[model samples]
Target chain A: MKEVTVGIDIGGTNTKFGIVDDAGTVLYQSKLPTQKHADFKDYIQELDSAIKHGLEQTSSDLQITGIGVGAPNANFYRGTIEHAPNLVWKGIIPIVDIMQKDFNVPVIITNDANAAAMGEMIYGNAKSMKDFIVITLGTGLGSGIVANGELIYGFDGFAAELGHVTVNPNGRNCGCGKVGCLETYVSATGIKRTVYKLLADHIEESELRGISFHDLSTKMITESAERGDSVAKAAFEYTGKILGSKLADSVAHTNPEAIFIFGGLSLAGDLIFAPTRKHLEANLMPIYKNKVKVLPSGLQNQSAPILGASSLVVDHLNKKSSVNI
Target chain B: MKEVTVGIDIGGTNTKFGIVDDAGTVLYQSKLPTQKHADFKDYIQELDSAIKHGLEQTSSDLQITGIGVGAPNANFYRGTIEHAPNLVWKGIIPIVDIMQKDFNVPVIITNDANAAAMGEMIYGNAKSMKDFIVITLGTGLGSGIVANGELIYGFDGFAAELGHVTVNPNGRNCGCGKVGCLETYVSATGIKRTVYKLLADHIEESELRGISFHDLSTKMITESAERGDSVAKAAFEYTGKILGSKLADSVAHTNPEAIFIFGGLSLAGDLIFAPTRKHLEANLMPIYKNKVKVLPSGLQNQSAPILGASSLVVDHLNKKSSVNI
Candidate 1:
């Protein structure tokens, strides 16, 4: 029988799942609106049927080895998802325990960023690297730190909250009840905020002048910057400066061989990477200069979340049997 | 036969060596001025003879097992001391290679902070902890990070340089050619700088008014604070605030169970600890608040350096033999 794993990615709007083979290939996939059910139990019940229907559509010889989940505010040690603000669920949810009971297989869970790091190690650019960091630059910045070939769960399993690290002390208010968090200035939303501030501060903008704050998006800013828009360009520059300087502080913490930029803002390519690399080099300690690389994620964009979640199963099975993949 | 190891602590002024048994006992100890010989070879020759003489004074049944050295800028991967400003050695000195050849036993070398971390794991308060941080507060600040029960040597074997992390982008100039490094405002010299700034900023009847910069010392400042000197007290409060806030950033990085303060400044007790703890809690993310303990080093002050260096040998031997001691 061919062995496969069920990979699940839980998001605020939709929940995506797939049957993945050992080679990181998604055999069958489906999605459901996350908030369609008011109760978490009802959501899980619908998810179970959806997954079973997906399995039936796939080739018949496949046997699911385990289930792996990626979600927000996931506690790996407790196998639960704690009060994640973006989620409709109000309290702690024992996702792994409930999934294991239904699937009758080992269930594992971690935050999406950590799962992404594992995917990078198993199938992306960090294959040969034991020490590296992956930064997810979506609506908010998230990070996964891999040192000595293992993810750092810390004492309470909530480690690597890089976005929440204080940047300006009193600069900007964050949703996490903190001020001047790195995410407030570096994520996609952060880039938009910077553009709005630039437009308000300068009158010489060729584009992005009349764009409403709610209507503005990072793609529009990226396109405008590509067309020589001064405000848009300055926004990316300012965002990179903050990210690069803070990355220097992180380099001091773990001294990773490379830092991979993943997710939405990363798609801006040289606009984000160039400034970040330039500032990272400029801000680094003399010994760390010209050594660490800042690179883009190697995983295919469309399948990244599913691939990341699936790789966790392979990693878990290998560890249990003392085998290296 | 009683197996013992030689532990060496190479300081700027002196080099201390001790013959230590398995149970962390010092059988014999001695010291020599580090700058007594100009050439690195001559210094090694003198150290070799000194160690032999000290070994002869110990019990006849003791068998030499290994050697461990702790010094500033020591590299574990390269087994060399690289461009240490405090040491007489100018460039990279292959101390481990030279010593291993001389003694015909396995030799290990790492920075003093990392050695202290190993000592804490083996014989100090972190014995039960797999994840913790040790910050040494002496003439300069140094740090050692432990995660997943292993020291983070990083990709270049120079991880955990927490002292050089920028506190302010435009603040005080650091000896490392950076501005506003944490150590520039938190070490013994850092405290002295703060006290001088306070003296210049305020016009109070103070005992520190007539003292020149060269005549000032952290010990004197501690005494003045105890005697209710406002300048001295403010200095401590300022130092603690910076240290505490930066520590919150570190907690976000590794999520350690505890942070141990070591060396000269830590000897001040509540003068430093109270402010540091207060600010650390005030600045920590809501999830990490009150979860991390900021405690003093559990190792005895006098023997800490020696014991720290000695523990490296025991740790190395255990790793080689696949034993957990």
Candidate 2:
């Protein structure tokens, strides 16, 4: 019988789940609204039912092996999600424990960025690379560090909070109650804020000037920049500069071979990668110059999240067997 | 016969070598002037003779198992010392290969800071720590990062160059050709520079005003601070603030359980520790705050360099055996 693992990605609004084989192929996949159920237990029950439904639709000869999950604020060590602001659940939720009780197979979980890093290592561009970093540029900037051929969970599970590292000591206030965080200048929301700042700083005529702060979106900014809007272009340049310079600092810490950019803003392509690479090279120390590469995530855009979450199980099983050997 | 490893620490002025057992004890130790010979081969020959002489003084039953050398710009993977500014050797010196040819035992090499970190993990305060950082505050700020209970060698052997990380974008001019590196603000030389800047900025400084930049030393600054001199005291505070804040960024990257301050500047004790700990706690993100301990190295002062170099052999053998198992 073919062995399969269930991969679940719990986002703020939607939770994506899929049945995946060891080769990272998605057999069956679906999504459920995360906020529809206020209670975490109810959400778990619905998720279980959905997964069961997905498994039934797949070939009957397939046997379940394990479950791997990716979520914001997920703790790999504790198997809990703690105080994730975007999630409806207010406090710590024992998602792994809940899943483990319902499923006979092993249940493992980590933050979305770490899951993405594991995916990269297992089935993406980093398959041959032993040391690298994955930066998820979604609503908030998230990072997962891989060193010595393993993910660095640190002393606590929350090691790679690259977003919260200060860019400016007193620049912008972050949700984490820190001022001048890297995310304040580099994430999807950060670029929007930068666009607004650019509009106020100069009298440049652009498409972004008409849109209100809440109504403005990263997609609109990307579209405007592609059409030669100075404000939108400046926003990407500014964002990339901050990201690139900070990544140079990250390089001094880990000295990774390459840094992969994942999630929403990465889709802007050269608009973001160009300035980031430029400034990163400019800011690096002489010994590190021209050595590190900044690249995009190799995972397919739509199925990337599922693939990342599912790869965790395969990685864990491989590690387990290797340790046994 | 009892098995022992030889540890060699090559410094700009002196080269220290010692015979050490697996129990972290120094069996026999001695030092020789490093820059006496113009050629690296001559230096190596002299070093080999010195080790042989020291070993002759030790118990005759001791059998050589391995040799570990710690020096500036040492590379673990290549086992070469590359472009060490302080060393007489102008280019890459294959010390490990040379030593391996002379001694029919394994020869390993890494930078002094990494050696110190291994020493910490094997016999110092970080014996039980799986994740921690060792900051060597001597001529320049050097760091060794330990994550997942292993030293981070990075893609290249030169991973933890934390001293070169930018503390200020356009601050001080560093010898490394970088502006405002962490070493410029936090190392022994950095504090001296800070003292000069403080003396220039404030007219209230009395004692340090008489001292020339070349005459000034970290020891003198510590003495003045101990004697309640405001300029010296303020220098400590300013240095601590920078070190602490930058360490907050370090914590964000690796999330170490503790950060151990080693080398010369660490000798100041509370003068450096108090302000650094306070600032480290203040600048850390909420989750990491109060979690990481800013502590002093557990290795004894005079013997630390030798111990650190020696620990590398034990660590390498242990890892090799574990992998074999």
Candidate 3:
């Protein structure tokens, strides 16, 4: 039986959908604008349309087994998208009910970080790993913790929010209204904030002098680093130092086998990797030093979110038979 | 079939053990001097004698299904006690293999903290909880993390060393050679240290000054607090404040349903509880405050270590079928 699953990776800007098979292949895919709807009903309608069109491209009769969704603030237990900052919707939206009604299949949803972790476990380099941490340092620091080959969704399906954990009590003001959060100092926006601070305080000549907040991006920082811009390079080093030390602290708690880095800031390669490794080792306990490996996510480019979402459905359905009752 | 298990809890000064049934009934129990043997093998023999006598006392010939051992620096995967600080054993001893040879029953081993956590899950307050952190604040701080209904044993089976984690980088020197560990501020020894510091600096009049470090203990501190000794009460207040804040950080990471504290320091009652609860709630995120319960261990008064250790063996043997290939 060719079990096809509808995988939706919902972002603030766009929602990407893919019709994936049981063999871990994406047979067809499409993208839709996310912010086009006021109530998000139009968004789901578009997603239904995308899945319908994608299914048509498959040669055999494609029986969509279920639906899996990955989005910011998606609550697994409630099957709803909770107060997600990026989304236009203000309150809870029952995404599962909507998706199931449209597709007539079992629907599930989880936070983006956990979905990415599942994707890595099922379809990426983390296949052989039983305990690994999937860290997505995009606009925010999102972490999906895998221990004993299962996602650690705590009592309320809210666990592994590494970004909100304090790195410094009085360091930086986080969007979460906390000070010195891991996310405040390590993510893409965090790097930009650091760069701006450096630009304002230090006397360095660089191409990013006049760039506004909207104009600047992690890509620009990477390009500047490649061109020997000391300020841009310093930003990465500072950010990575905080990240590395935080990783050491994290190791003390979970002792994960490896940490997988994915998302925007991670694309900086050595700019982020070198300093992170150095600081992580310096801060780690003697027993744990250099024991945990840092690796890049196996999914290429933008395929991660989609694959991660789909992986949830695939893994969950597989494990459903375990309950004897 | 009626099955029983032997649970052994090894401490620096003494060892306690019991024969425990499936319903958590302690059929027979005893305590013996841990210093009975200079040789590791001798200690094992003594433990064997204890277990044999305990089983014989029970009427029905219940099959001894398993043996559980808990000690400092114990390793679950290796089933060995390695270079534990207090144990006179000079090197790694495969205690599980030694025990298995005696009865041909399954044997399991874990550190003391993990055993306590297992005891909580199987026989104590956290029986209904799958996500919780059990912190033992005795001579030192020890944490056992339970996530997704299982103990999180890391790659080296040495995960959940929350005490050694840096809560403050420059605060205090820990026995682990680290600075500002949570244990250095919250454990029984840590509380006395806080009392001395308060005495030396605060210029407060108190009965605590009459006592020497040789006789001073957390028990004395609680007594002084009950007698209205300003410095002694302040020490516990200070200890609770630090512990609670550290726990708040723990909440941010694991988001556990509850944090159960056991051991001497927790015996101070509201002298420790009030400040801890206040500070924990003050520091916790809005979603976690009031939602996350910080409570004392239900097994606080009982000789839980041996029970916990015994529970480990039972839990391990119970899970054997899960890993059956």
Give lDDT for model 2.
0.92
Tens-digit per-residue lDDT, B1-325, candidate 2: 9999998999999999899987888899999999999998999999998898888889878898899899999999999999998888799998899999998899989999999999999989999999999999998999999999999999988799999888889899999888989999999899999999988888894698999999999999999999999999999999999999899999999999999999889999999999999988878889887899999999957888888988888888998998899
Deviation of model 3 at A8, angstroms: 0.7
Residue A295 C-alpha lDDT in model 2 = 94
lDDT of 1 by residue, B1-325 (tens): 8899888999999999999887788888889999988899999999999999988888768788999899988999999999998878799999999999999998899999999999898889999998899999888899999998888999999899999998999999898888899999999999999998998888987798889988999899999999999999999999999999999999988899999999889888999999999999988889999899999998856778888888888888877775331
Query: For candidate 2, what is the DockQ-based docking class?
Result: high
Top lDDT model: 2
Per-residue lDDT for A80-160 in model 1, tens only? Answer: 999998888889999889989998998989999998988899879999999999999999999999998888889889889
TM-score of each candidate structure, all chains considered together: 0.97, 0.98, 0.95
Q: Report the first chain's TM-score for all candidates.
A: 0.97, 0.97, 0.95
Please provide, for model 2 over A176-255, each residue's C-alpha lDDT reduced to its tens digit, 9 standing for 90 to 100.
88899999999989999999899999998998878999999889999999999999999999999999999989999999
Candidate 3: CAPRI quality band: medium
**Superposition error at A222 for model 3 (Å):** 2.3
True contacts kept of 2: 0.78
Tens-digit lDDT string for candidate 3 (B28-87): 888888877898788888878877877777755778888888899898999999888787
What order do you get sorting by lDDT, best first? Answer: 2, 1, 3
Model 2 sits at a Cα RMSD from the real structure of 1.2
**What is the interface RMSD, in angstroms, for predicted model 2?**
0.7
Best by DockQ: 2
Task: Point out where model 2 deviates above 4 Å.
Answer: none
